[model samples]
Target: MKKTKILFYDMKDYDIEFFTKYGKNYNFEMKFLKVKLSEETAYLSRGFDVVSAFTNDDINKNTIDILAKNNIKLLAMRCAGFNNVSLKDIKNRFQVVRVPAYSPYSIAEYTVAMILAVNRKVHKAYIRTREGNFSINGLMGFDLYNKTVGIIGAGKIAQILIKILKGFGTNIIAYDPYPNYEIAKELGFEFVDLDTIYEKSDIISLNCPLTKDTKYMINRTSINKMKDGVILVNTGRGMLIDSVDLVEGLKDKKIGAAALDVYEEEEEYFFEDKSSQVIQDDILGRLLSFHNVLITSHQAFFTKEAVEAITVTTLENIKDFIENKPLKNIVPQDNN
Candidate 1:
């Protein structure tokens, strides 16, 4: 039997190794492409059975159309989020699959790490110690115990975070349109309204997916409702919070601190080394200048378990598509 021809695009060295090892077990002829999947790069997958993509790749309508034209049937995404892909355009043209729940624990743990680092000012302390300044002034941090924490989304990642925060004895209040009452009851979390969460929570964490309804969900209006000196953490989508509003809030001292693993306009420069070069994005540059803010290079999902799970699940999706079997993680056009 002929081995299945697979073109994996925008994959790193480790990712390529993982796929190469796993694909050999299933007799898949895997071709790794360093270039991203776009209209211009779609021709690279000609005569291939499937095209694998990563989060940063451009899987827009034109790209999907090109892939369909080139006889690429399967679009396999190694990441959970599919907001970058055009669902409407690829509905009938090609089948889509994604690794939806790779490792919620990785993201949850990273979120907590950000929260702790910001509150304790660990980043600043490290810098100060390196500079031979032993002064501990203005490094006061409150205990997590008995503090009110507001979680915007109550999905798998949020649930894991809630369990961890509960270990710290923090008061949990969550705002989700479809609340998980069972989990709330088991974990002693309160399902409150969005405004109540804004007014009451000492720390606010965003763990929701980005959609048309959730775009700029945390804007100037919502920022005004937040408690003064609130700590904000976002390990979710970057567009969930408005950059302009967040800068204004930081300027006005409305937000005491922020720990962001994602940014609204991070696509242009994230996951690459631009440190030696001049910073171009004004909002991002200003965000970096603030002493109270902590930013990471979208590495919340970078973990051994997460990476293995993503690789295994991605390959399994391709195998299922080729065998005409049921796809567990098939991404439909309307998952509303």
Candidate 2:
């Protein structure tokens, strides 16, 4: 009997470490490729039974056609979000499975860290203290107690973040298309309309997934409704907020501070060392120039636990496919 062959794209050291350690138990032949899955790189899947992609891989129509032609049965995504993949293209071509919720706590905790760092200027303080300047001259920050926090999505991560915020005695308001009333009641948070979330909320956090309706949700029109000097935090998809509009908001003093773990055009820069090169993207350069803006290279969900969970879940998804087990995490044709 031939063993299942899996081609892992966008391979990194950590991914290799965890997957290789656990993959031995599954008795599968796994190959790692540093190149991302794209139209050009999709041809390499010819002899593989499964193509394992990461968050940044290009999984559009062109790539899917190649993978399908190569007889790839499964597209296993190691990350939670599949926004990079075109679901319609893969509808009848091949089955897709993803690690949907691998350590929500990692994301939730990182979000809290970004929020606190930006609001209290903790990042700046560390730098100032290191420079031997202990003056609290420009370190004024508002208290989190009694602050109104608006969450865009009420998923597991958002709920966990809300619980943490509640410890600071915050008024939590969330907006989700499919709101869980029971969870809202239990979490002591209210589900409100987007308009209400904008009108109120001293601190606005975008935890929503990127969809047709959610892309650029924080444009100039919505930014106009937010409270002046509002702190914005986004650990979700980068496309959820309009980068250009955010710059304008910062310039006009509408947004006080911003903490971003993802950017709309992060594929070229994130997960790689670009310290030696000049940032070519103008908008990203502008964002970095802001004193109140804090940008991280999409490492919110990069905890040790999350990595192990992702590896185990991805391998299990493949195992299920090979054994003809039901794929519970399969990406449906019309999934939104």
Candidate 3:
């Protein structure tokens, strides 16, 4: 009885700690690689039963072809969003599984943190106080009580955020293709159209997944509709907002403040220390130059609880694939 072997790319220290702990009980042989999965790294998958990767990994058609050629049977994604993967190109070569829900509270709470930090300038205050400057001038902030907050995508995490915002006495408006009318009625939040959400929200938060319908959802036309001096936050996928358009909105004073935990081209910079190098992305550099803009690395899902849940679920995906169990989280490559 040979144990299943898995080659995990983009392996970080936390991944090592948690996976090693849970995976030992599964009797699986794990080969962890620090480099992110890509066409160039596909050859490394040879002889492995499956390839496990993170959000930044490029699991495109070419890489899939190579992995299929190397006898890899499954693509196990540790993160929820699989937009980086070319699912259409999968073409039934192998099954894809992901950890769809992992400590939604971590992300929901982080979203609230960004909202408070951006609106109240709490992060700036901490810095100013540390520098011995306690002046309140230029530190004027808005109150969240009775503020209009618009949320996109009412998923598990968004639901948690709604509950949190309700405590603040906010007027919550959400937009999701399949609106949960029951939840909306119960939570006392209203479901509205995209135009309404954009036109009315004082603080807008993007909590949606990235899809063909949602990529660059916040662009020039949509930004023009938003209230002037609106505070924006995105803990969702980065490609959901157009970087250039967002920068322009900030420059033209259409958006008052932005707190972003994700950026469109974050793969090159996030999750790694780049203190020795100057940022090469002009858009990212411009974003960092603003005092009103707060940018955090893609760390919303980086809580201790989230990491353990992700590791456990990802390993379970691997085990289920190897054992030929029904994959509830399998991402279907084709609906046709």
lDDT (Cα) of model 1:
0.92
In angstroms, give how far residue 148 of model 2 lies from its true place. 0.5
lDDT tens digits, residue span 134-211, model 2: 988877889999999999999999999999999999999999999999999999999999999999999999998988
Candidate 3, residues 9-128: lDDT per residue as tens digits?
Answer: 998888898988888889699989999999999999999988999998888889988988998889999999898898877788888999999999999999999999888888889899
- Among residues 3 or more apart in sequence or in different chains, the pairs in candidate 3 whose N, CA or C atoms overlap within 3 Å are none
lDDT, ranked from best to worst: 2, 3, 1
Q: Write the per-residue lDDT of candidate 1 for residues 16-124, one digit (tens) a residue.
A: 8787777777968888988888888998888998999988888887898889988988899989889999888876778899999989999999999999999999999
Best model per TM-score: 3
Cα error of candidate 2 at position 10, Å: 0.6
lDDT of each: 0.92, 0.94, 0.93
Colliding pairs, model 1: none
Regions of candidate 1 where Cα sits further than 4 Å from its true position: 334-336
Q: Which one is best on lDDT? A: 2
